[model samples]
Target: MHVVVVTKNTPDTAATVTVKGDGTIDWGDSLVVNPWDEYAITEAVLLKEAHSGKATVLTVGTDEHQEALKHGLAIGCDQAIRVWDGALDGCDSLGYAEAVAAAIRKLGDVDLVIFGRELADIATDQHVYQVARKLGWTMLGYVAKIQALDVAARSITVNRLTEYGTQTVRSTLPAVISVVKDINEPKYPTFIGIRKAAKAEIPVWSAADLGLDAAALQPRTQQLRYQELPKREGTVEIIEGATAQEKAAKLIDRLIEEKVL
Candidate 1:
């Protein structure tokens, strides 16, 4: 089985996000793997070991994306692919899905593809579906547990967590799965693994390398503006009455008048 895990470079959740007056973000060189992708990485590593398969990390970004790729390698991925196409700038979810799907197709004979339930930066949670659509593969999303995966049989079964309840899904191999954070606990890379990953040669690719059309990579959406959230203000008031009944009556009236009842 060959497993591919998709990851993305994003600001550390702990990092302070600041928007400049000119509407540009000041990242200040702090970057890390999207927190949610950690689950996908862990799942890929576990699945690879269980099935004696190969696991690879795939990412799309600039030079700063190396950190995220290395982190995945340190965790247990066999190799990494970084797509740094200049034409991918400002690429939205659809564009990203296109590039990643193209790369996967280039890899050839892949059995499984994994992704985080959502990207932390955008939080749109659309990459998995988009990539699956592009590849014409079965996509199981919000997977909380991979109950079964049979590479030889070319089949898989998983329990997905939905808003209403958990749903069990069965699909064939060559599928795309988006795992939620509850799927598994991510393991921290050991010192030895970290050192090895740091030295690993992560090949970078461009749109041409993936046989992708630059025109198709153009983003469909545009940002209109960026505005800081307004600061919250608080005020406190105590309901007053001489007696319990009086207080109750006053509170009822106030709630009724405010339409909060």
Candidate 2:
């Protein structure tokens, strides 16, 4: 039983965002693991603990990505792999998925691949499906609960939350799944884990190592513009009346006067 958790490095939620002259986001020094991916890591850790296996954390980024891998190690991942290639810088979602899927294939004998529903920076929410397609594996998205996993049968059953209702899905091993935060609570790093993570030697793999072509890694999408939205302005008005019924009437009148009703 081997589980691989895919994660991303993202700017802290509270960090101020600005755009560079190139129309690319200038994320400040504050960075952390994608918050949603933490849930996937938690679920993978729990699965490994219950079934006796190893959880490997995988990420695609520059040296800064090592921080996310270290955090994954501190949270209980057995191994961490950093996929970095100069050709991958600013790669589109399709190219990223291709590289990630290639890396996963390089790590043979992997039973499960877990990921967050989306990355905070891009928020396209398309990488998981693209990875699954590239890998030719079953893709389960929006997974809320993992009901059962039969190692011998090499199958897993989960409850997926949908707009209509929860749908039970079962898939065989070597599948890719994206989990929601509702699936599990991520654990905080302990002192011992932190010490181990600090001393851990995470291996970095490049596109060539994964048999990826530099030409294929070029980004298909381009950013036309990046600008911070203007702050919103609003005016508040108070309704006054002698009685509650009168106040209700005044509110209705005001609403109709403003054509808001």
Model number with the top lDDT: 1
Q: What TM-score against the true fold does each predicted structure earn?
A: 0.90, 0.92
Candidate 1 pairs with clashing backbones: none
Q: Deviation in angstroms for 222 in model 1?
A: 1.3
Error of 1 at 105 (Å): 0.5
For model 1, where is the 10-residue window of minimal lDDT? 230-239
* Candidate 2 residue pairs in clash (backbone atoms < 3 Å): none
lDDT of 2 by residue, 207-240 (tens): 8899998787878887687877876777678888
Lowest summed-lDDT stretch of 10 residues in model 2?
227-236
CA displacement after TM-score superposition, residue 45 of candidate 2 (Å)? 0.7
Candidate 2 TM-score, C-alpha based: 0.92
Q: For residue 116, what is the lDDT in candidate 2? A: 87
